[model samples]
Target chain A: MKLTRTGVFTIVVALAFLAVPYAATLLGSNYVITLATRVAIYAIVAVSLDMLVGRSNLVSFGHAAYFGLGGYAVAISAFHLANDVPIFGWAGTNEALIAWPLAMFVAGFGALIIGALSLRTAGVYFIMITLAFAQMLFFLFVALKYYGGDDGLSLSTRNLFAGNRITDARTFYWICLAALAICLLLSWRILNSRFGMVLRGAAASERRMAALGFPVYRYRLAAFVIAGMMAGLAGALWANQNRFVSPDMLSWVRSGEFLVMVIMGGLSSLVGPVVGAAAFLLIESYLSGWTEHWQMVFGPFVLLVAVFAPRGLWGALRGKGDV
Target chain B: MQLVLEQLLNGLQLSLTLFLLAAGLTLVFGIMGVINLAHGSLYMIGAYAGAWAAAKTGTFWLALPAGLAAAALVGAAMELLVVRRLYAREHLSQVLATFGLILFFNGFIAWSAGRSPLLMETPPQLSGFVEILPGLPYPAYRLAMMGVGVAVALGLWYMISRTRIGMLIRAGSDKREMVEALGVDIAKLFTLVFALGALLAGLAGVMVGPIRSVQVGMGEQVLITTFVVIVVGGIGSIRGAFAGALLIGMCDTLGRAFVPMLLKSWLSGPLADGLGGALSSVIIYLVMALVLIVRPRGLFPVSG
Candidate 1:
């Protein structure tokens, strides 16, 4: 209810992000709108990952597995529906209302299975197991020749958004922005609630939380599912944006990229991920424009940020105490 | 019968390669408490160096030392410049920093090497097949690799159990502060251990370069499997690494060769192939999961 400096800054930033499409239109550059949409989609994933990495003290190296699962869900369903074929005895539907929620549930279910097994261990084991599970899923998809396999599944058009034409870049961008804003708001509420406090307490000291009678595993599992579903939502949007889905979407490299965004944005803050995603995309665009080997420049830049700017761009901008 | 024997040999070769990489990884991780995602880059560097040297000199013998020296030098420089700062940091920071290093090395290698896999030729002296048993012949190069792996394993065991630096390394793993208090330059010791690990990884990369494509990202593929080895073997134990590598190598190689054939009786050819391929690829991960369920600390956890 009361406006703090952090709150005010967040609102201004959100407004500026919402205004990007209009500005891009005014400048007659639809490419900018599309790029901004990508940043927003990736921001959704980074924030979801932050719930695990930042708040829950669970550093998953396989978040991309869920994200990719979400994308595959949409692509597979759309493919089946287009061909009038039943997938595993069930008729596929292209309805966004049906497909998107199904995608979320599928990803959440995947998280449930993976988390149940991976959560049995802590520290480095958890990271490697998650990575291994994701790689398994990646290989599974790669071997599925029925789903286009390594070439990836392509959709003729974006999934219909309640009968609205999402083919328009501006319309799609607004949809992605809305999704990001809603996820951010939901995450903010979750982090402030009692459940979030328990999660944070567990992160700080798992043994202490357990001593205090908290079922740490269950809470952590809940957070993992929530984060996975949120990332899955982002994946659905990403699939729509690109009009394709591939094994690359679920690769360990993508998971690393998601982690990089969270770290580069400032791990402790809520809005840091969005800022990180934006900065990453913008820098990538500019660097790629300069040379074919942009990763040579981009990789070292990330290293510089990790080493020198431990506070990240947002933390530095907010100064010392704000985070 | 011959096919099974050949697959077993393949498994042995694969296991030895993994042992070389995992032994180094487990050592660095056990002693420094740093999870290095860029260790794979050291493997890639060794492969490139060896490939380049072998091509220039037209001799495999020169390439061996060239790869080891290159990897050791790079590993030492990396330790001094970047890794030393990460020793006191959290695992997340270490993961991120090392990940950045991976990207840098991969991109740098691609840029320098022109994005194509380089070719390495096995020396003629080690190219022919040799009889290992009655009616069973194996590639001499692969046999030589197994011999080297066994020799190195014995050498490592002796070094760790008998030498002064090995004593320091063992002590440091147990208690870093106490080792420093004993007036040992812990930093130099860490650098040396890290360089040694890198040297072993280089040895692996150069030896396997002729067998596999010497490409930019090859290190990453093997790196993940090496992690699986260390995890299943018990993190810091070299003996565990060796045992885990052999187990995984056998499981992977045998599964790939036999699973589809077994499935062929019940399923269509293409479907069985797909399922078998998928199952075989994930067999090690499944093994890792089961191991963690049974022994979360791994089979041979070294007490720290």
Candidate 2:
């Protein structure tokens, strides 16, 4: 196997991510590590969304639903564990091993249900349905005041891993980075698999795939669930990073931002979302620091990308014929 | 009985307001094949413009024309500057580009308006209550709103069903190439339609200004609800929008009024109130879900 240009790019990016904590310590600012962690978590989300948009041609307008659900899973469990209260007749635990899987499961279950109904429709209907369903969940969380309502809940501390808390910023960053790498590897594998081919084929021409006797709907649903689970893990990690969970995480704007990240980074080529997530956060933080009305500039910048650079920063940077 | 009657009227008023927003959105989607997320921004713009004009003149009447004109001008400018370029692009591109427009518009409004909600006073002539029944008094302003909504609906129906412009619009929806081939300047028509849509959204904003605080980001709330209406109704169908709007409006208003009361029978007071409040909010979405399950294409899908 030859080391390609993308291979070199990936290694460089990975090295940079790994060195973030060390640089932050050298600079005596943990904010750099926090921002890097956010990029990693968001990259996971963007990658999950890319599975649908870049590969399956499904433009889900509500991917944040899963992300929020994952966070809520951890928050709710930790709340009960701290309070020594039993929810649904079962005692809650703040163990990462248990809570994280539960988070992924909850999010994947949500996807199964939402996808089942939303997949019934196509095109604009699918987009709107997914969004409305997410909004439904958002409202549900807002209404459930026991979990702190619109104000949200804060974890007493980060979840324990193997009976010990992973409290160090560097350790948490490494864990998140490892998760991102795993997600990227999983995405690459799926993209190369027959299931991925079926999804791509269905995206290209649903009728053609159906004619070829493939279970296109089932394939799509499976991919949707997988993406949701990945986003759930990202969400869980995100909650831990902040030690707070709010209804704001589930808001439609976040879902829209996720789409922006995927499109701005480039789509389908697993690595595009990671680059996109990093660029989005960096630009957002920089502009916000300059002025409160950062969106004014950021908005027009997005418009420029949509109008001019259809393939996004990745495509633009890679030059021609790379895709 | 009187409370139910009042809530029913409230539902009617809300439905009409929603219809105003939905008609334009569906019309654009039908004819332009563009999924414009910025349509709500036009609504907000209309409200802001009207509120500014109303405050300056100290008259609610001026708000009507001001809102309409501002929305139309902005909508036309947006159409020409951004949306027109997106006509040939995919829906995703249109969505993102328009989403960008939303961010720009929202930020611009916050910067200019200082992040505070503008207040519009209800005119004295429309502020008092009128006895619609022998003993039940309804706010005259809301009654006037109902009247305007009905008049606009009738006017829209007449314009779309009877006028030459309406004929061209129907033709444009049915056969875009043929209409363009028949010497109709499609570009001008698109701008006209978009401006008309903006005008209607502005009308809604102006009507709502006195009752609700005119604020930045207000359009997004209405925009999402309007999406539910469009989905419940069918895309590109005026009748579908009206029907969906009525269903959602009635469901929302009645659910909010009665759900807590109904829940109080079985649950404790606080729990019922809290849960009911949440349930009432989601009732329309539940209705939308049921509609999707029963008729995924919406109640009246227009085949493209």
Candidate 3:
């Protein structure tokens, strides 16, 4: 039960996140709350990606597919609920308990199918194939006219939590914070378990793990599904954040940004992705506010990070063998 | 039949353009073991440079070399400045660093050139149509592009197979250490290969500019498709790239041209249209997936 340095750091960061709404009230602006909620949601997705990139040695360039699917799940459910129509013998409900899990399930199912195929190839092929599948899904959503197509779909209202609709930015921020906390704890538990060891082992050398009778493919696929579901939850929260869902959410660029966050945050730990997500969004927001051409500065900054800070900000702070 | 023929020609034109892009991408990946996400930016630079030159000079001829030179110079600078440091890095770092380069280049281009799309007119003589068959007339400019593509492919084949540099390139990809041990400056060879790849990308950008509007972020759209091409073709295999490009271009063009019509024959209007549009757009990806399932190494993997 003793607190390590990282444990203490985590507590401080958590406390800081909890104080955001109070700070926003003092500042007389809700912008920070909204931005924090976004960071929290993105953190969920980025952490899930780290499970693959950092733990399993699988670098998926299409993790956004699940996120977008999760968002669309919420949007589509809301769409059907508003229309008073039954889809597949069930009436749509705006209950967060129902819609949120549905989003995660849909995203997990998508990962299952994509993973089944993509896992057949390794290295560059795996990366490109995953990307292609994500693009395929993006196009599918874009071409679906009923759900708003290229223009995207808007939710009628925020989903009710336990029969009460959550209103206001502070409330949403707390909910997102709670979700991120639960995800982090669950990820921490899973990564430390024996299964986590096997996953890490498979990543280190798939051949060795398979030879040891670990069923490497199944473990990787399981990890992929879990990560997909986590990202899906983030995507669902994201949809509710804006009350909208767009094909742009599933774009390759978004996927790339997620990768950058995982790498920039520090790889292979529960805390890294959250740190990376916060850093990425804050820097992006700050830079854009300074000038219209923010990417010109941000791009070089990323390059400099890659060249000089290969271990990422967190890893650098933690020093050697930190992960 | 006439429609099919016209679509076929269109497919070929698109295929050749993709081939030009794919060749450079595959070459760089095959030889240097680098996954450069900014290869498309070099293409953009080419198109932008060519478009600017053509606008200023009132001639497309000057634009060709202008595009090539600019792309080569920028590409060389990129190699020396950024990619040189990435030679020994892992693929993830390489992907991120190059991805950063993409963001910088795109933002820089938009900032410097204005965000509006730039137009490049087809050269006067080739702007007109040519009668290939008694009833089938095609744009002469497109025909000219095909000719250029064929010529480049042949030239590439000759250079890779017939010249001393070609021998070095072949040797370099196969055994970098051995080549270096034999007194070849592997670093210089890498830069040359990278510049060569950039030059080809630039040429593709210039050729495609007159066909499609020259604009920021256009490289990304083509870059993904080029990735598909390289994946479908064996990575680093020139023959595979050509084959993959042709397969993807023809499938995509033909699917887009005919899928809706075919769907309309059997289904209702809106559903058919939507389904067909979606299916056609994803057909190439499906093709890639199928290829991976059947042949995980792609159609012509060069490594083993």
Candidate 4:
């Protein structure tokens, strides 16, 4: 397949991510490696969010619900297994092979229910309902005293990757990178396929797509589930990376951050969210190191981007005429 | 019976606050076509302003107008600076920009006021309890709040239905171009409406500051519930906002009061409490979901 400028840039960026661990080691900075890992994990979520926000025109404000659910799934399972306690009469396992897919499935199931209900509304109602649903789940987790309630739960150890030690920063970074790569590849294929065309068409005009005999709601719900599962995958990786899961993971602000990453990257392109995520984390890390009130500066920056660069960083990089 | 009545009264008070918040949101949304995520920020601004003023003057009356003016000025400035540009943008763009505004406001508040919650004392006169029923004494402040809400509701009805500017507002929401063409400065009308909404939200904030802690991010907690109120009442309808707020307030307050007690017979104490807490928190969202399913446009959808 021929590569466009965006495609080439995406590959170069992916390669750079792969090289980060070596570069960090050369620079003798463990913090850079960890920050890169965070960027990659958040990139997974932002890319997944882009599928709905950019392609399907469904701007979900509560996406952190799925991300948090995925983390909780891992943390809760690990907690149960380590304590030798059966939660709700079911034994838990700390195996990554078992826990990761389960996390995805659990998050996907949540998306199915939330999306089904939220999809019935359009525009602002959809946004607020999604937020409300996420908040509901956030409160649910907060009320689960067995899981540490508001304080959150910590895993005894990171989920084992087929008995491999993922606790090493380099190894965990690689795992996160691989997950993000798979997500990007999958998103690329899905966006190019006929199914993606239907989604884009639906986003453009649901009425027109409906008239064209497309089951728009089903397609949108399917997309929502897919995005949720991807975010859940990211969440699972994040839990393993930190070996901690908190109710803060599911807060609406986290969801807003994900949205910001997607918008900053540029919503129009497949690679935009990844770029957005990296830039957001990097800028945040750099700014916060300098001052405690970094958000005061960052908030206006985001506002300026929203108002002026609606097409996002990717769009600006791709040049104005392309959009 | 007394407990239920008390809970019902609590719901009424809560609903009144929600109506104040939702009324502004729906009005701004209905007329401007902008879905403002920063509406909650305006609420925070009002609370901070009220708290600050109350701290300085030691008077609730002075604090009230101070909060109103602060919020109104901020709202008007926000409309002039950022929201004016968003009038022609898509909803997503509008949402994003306003969301950025939320972060900015939150950060600004925290930076200015510090991380601690501000304390606002209720005026000593209104702090006293009044006998509302034969054997029940209710807080005078809460009863006063309910009265203010009802009066605002009636006044809003009169202004919207019986006044010239109200006619223009109704007309503007329906047909902005028509109103503009008819020699109404649509921009000024929008600013006025936006400021009015901000003032009402501020009024609610000041009134409730003594009852609830005035802190950063408090607006967000109330904002989501206000969103529910608007969604359930049908977006853009003042009447719908009023009805939706009352329904949600009653459901939420009563659910929190009774759901656990009712569940106790079937479940253990801790489990029942957890379940009840979770269920009660979600009661309004459930109502919103049900309302959407049954009447997607809301119960009182205003016809264009």
Candidate 5:
């Protein structure tokens, strides 16, 4: 594992992520730490999505359904826990550890239902259906008047851990860093496990894998659930960081932004999604400072890459070596 | 009942608008094999251009063709500049690239025209309603939309199904190699088809301007519905697109109008309203899901 390129790369990146926060404290680079924090969250989501998108070759347009649902779970949970409302009378925890896992469950469950129906579709139909499912979820959230609806929900405070002050910046950063590490490790293990091997073979050649006795559909659904859990993790962190959860988190546009991160960073490569998320956030932050309509400039530029450099950022950097 | 008749007319009007968008979208998918998520952006552009023109000249007639032309021209340029290069990429790349176009276009329009809906006045000739039944009447503009939509559909059918060029499109869908073997300029045919599709989308946008206010990001809401229609109708199938468009239009409108009323009759009013509103919005998607379950290739898949 240590010798493998992905493993080595992961270690180096993880070290940098750790070193950056400490360095931020030393050098007073809170901005950089904050930026890295966002990158870490987005990367978790992107890597999880790669499980389905890259490993299984299931292009989902509704991955945001989990993301938005995860945020809602945290928000709604906080609402109930703070008000001392029971889960139909059972006490709820206001802590993120419990809330985070619960959010993951809700997100994963939703993905399970959507993927079951959508995975049955392939090619163009598959794309549109997945997209439509995501949009449907988006609309549902938008239409709900109970929890901020279109306006969104804002938490009074970040979710607390059992004994730790999660409100502390450096502490929160380390906690996020640990979560990211666990997520990446889990993703890598899943891809290399026996299950992972079968999944990849199915992606490369679904028909051949089926003929060889693999239940391709189940693997794809499992991958989708895995991906949804990852996105839910991000959404949970995002809610804590921003203390807000809105339909915007689950929009098709936001989903598209994730796709951009995956592509610009390098699709099919584990490190690519992380790198892409970092670069995208950094660039967009800088560009938006210069002009309000930076998207007009940036949009075509990204399109140029998609059109001309289909290999994406990672692909362009490593060439055939990465693939 | 007059309510049913009126809803049918509204549905027909809506169907024509959808047909325009769907026809262009499905053709691009069928012939070029690229998912232009920004097809809606092109639709948006047409609306913007036409609205700008109508606002400037104070004449809806002149603005109509100007919008159509502007969209067609932009479509050609887009085909030449960006869309052409994306033909061989994976659908994800297409989705991303076009999505970028959406962001760009939305921002560009906002910067240039401000983020407000542009109001276009309807022409006097098309603004009146005529009595159809003893006590019921329909808006003339909606009737005109149905007429124009039917005419355009017929024109497209004739062009594709009855003309020499039509044979090329039929061949192009299934046997591009064969069409190229026949010494036809296949590249030109592609450009023509893309341009035609763009023109139709533009026509839809321009015609829709009179019905509602034109604004930024309007293309997005419509784009999804059009995609639904294409999926239900079967990509690359014109007749299927038409039928799917009408079915979707009717289901969407009637679902919105009557679902809550029906639900109220069965359940308590408040619960019915809450769930009904949500269910009404999902009616089209529900219809689509059922259709796909039965006919995965869509209701009227083009043989090609």
Candidate 6:
């Protein structure tokens, strides 16, 4: 493929993102580092969601179930590993590097199960069922008493990455940046692969895909699981960032927030999620200061965007959805 | 036996309320092919409107009709001003727009109502109990709700099935081109359908006000139930909505009511209580999963 103008522009934007934190570092501001870390984490989830919502045409309103499940896994595992207790004389490990894989597995597995059942139906049923299932998990977490329940569980500190490096803000931010960079690369690779084509085909014409002997359901379910696993990675970062995991992370509202990130960034583009994450967090930061009813203002803004500029911020800026 | 009867009555009452909510939702989806997430907001509007009116004048009856009217007005305005544009847009746009509306409505109402649950006291006329079939005492209001719901159901069936206008709606959903070719104005039909749908939802809200606390987010919870109802019943089918609503309402109410008792009989109190509450919450989803497995299109799928 030729190095097109849009591709170059994406590189420039990404470079800008990478340089901004360092630029802030030179200016002696730590706030940009935290914000950068958040953008990277949200980018991980947003990119994954794009596979389903943008390419596959599956509008899952319950993606938070996987994300929250992943967060809980890390939190629960860390607790057990720290406490070193077991009913059958088994102890959990506090090694988050090892625990990250476990979180991904749990989150991915949960999405696969939910998606397998939910993807059976289409249209309003699909959206509502996914939402219903997600809400079920949300309520389950709220009812679950042992691991913090409704109030959420907090870690004593952030997870360790080969010693105290994880505790350092700069080190942690770099790790998140690297992790997100790797995810973007992986997303690119997968999107260009045969599996990605199948997802796109299934999304574009499920019936045609079926007529052509392609098992559309498997492709979609695979995409859903993959997205869930990516969101799990984001969840791990969120837990480590705040050293907290709550039922709110798994709520329907969070799913809506995730969608907003995707929509604000531009649905069809890869880097749009990252850009969207930055804009949304910034908007959230300033809006919350304006009034307690920030949502009311934000809601109408979203409406205006939907009505007037359906292509979103990235799409509007780039002539050909070059995001 | 009496306890079982009461639970069944409770389930029936809940089902009646859900039927009213789902009827509008299914119709909009069927006729307009639009998913209105703010449908619940209309229910919330009805509740708050009625609550405010009833509180001011101490007249539940007056408040009920007025509340329904206000909700219908909001629904019609939504259809005309915002939702009309989304008719040809993608599901994503529709979702974003409707979701935005939900947030806007919640915040707007919260601003006005002060974020507290508004109390709706029962009217004097419908405050008593009615004994049915040997000491099975039930609230007259709930029984009246059931009666009203049944009457509405029958009225809807009569309109849609037996009337020419109803045939037009059915035709409009399945084949709009064909309906148009038959000399019917499809655009006008859509707006009318939307208004009617809102009216039903508003009535649902008004009926539900007396039983539940009228609050900002009450409709949001019930909306989830309505989704399950429409899904299990089959979109674009009123009969499907009725069956699914009653089925779901029964499962949810009975599950919540009986799970603890059933568990307590065989297990310890604390464990039973914990599992019971969790299990009850999941019952509707479980039922939906079961229905999807058996019939993906729903129990009473619409014929194209």
Minimum summed lDDT over a 10-residue window in model 2 chain A is located at: A314-323
DockQ of the two-chain complex in candidate 5: 0.68
TM-score of 2: 0.98
The runs of at least 3 residues in candidate 5 whose Cα sits more than 4 Å from the true structure, single-residue gaps closed, are: A1-11, A27-29, A83-93, B302-304
Chain A agreement with the truth for model 6, given as TM-score: 0.95
Question: Backbone clashes per model, in order?
Answer: 0, 0, 0, 0, 0, 0
lDDT by residue for model 3 (B22-103), tens = 9998988888888898999999999999999999998999999999999999999999999999988888888889889999
Tell me the TM-score for chain B of model 5.
0.97
Model 3 misplaced stretches (Cα beyond 4 Å): A1-3
User: Worst lDDT window (10 residues) for model 3 chain A?
Assistant: A314-323
lDDT over C-alpha atoms for residue B67 of model 4: 95
lDDT (tens digit, per residue) of candidate 6 on B9-116: 999988988999899999998888898888999998988888889988889988988888998899889998999999898878888888888888888888778787
State every prediction's TM-score relative to the real structure: 0.98, 0.98, 0.98, 0.98, 0.96, 0.96
DockQ of predictions, in order shown: 0.71, 0.73, 0.78, 0.74, 0.68, 0.64
Candidates sorted on DockQ, descending: 3, 4, 2, 1, 5, 6
Better of 1 and 6 by DockQ: 1
- Model 2, position A71, has a per-residue lDDT of 99
User: Candidate 4 on B115-234: residue-level lDDT in tens?
Assistant: 899999989989999988899999999999999999999999999999999999999999999999999999999999999999998888888899999998999999988988998998
Per-residue lDDT tens digits of candidate 4, residues A1-323?
97667767877887889789889979999998999999999999999999999999998999999999999999989998899999889789788899999999999999999999999988888988899899888888887777898998888899988877688898888888889989998999999998999999998899999999999999999999999999999999999988999989999889999999999999948889999999999999999999888888888898899899999889888775653
Q: What would the per-residue lDDT of candidate 1 be over residues A26-57, giving only the tens digit for each residue? A: 99898889899999999999999999998888
| Candidate 5 lDDT over residue span A156-198, tens digit each | 8899888566987777777777888888889879878988998
Please give the C-alpha DockQ score of model 3.
0.78
CAPRI class assigned to model 6: medium
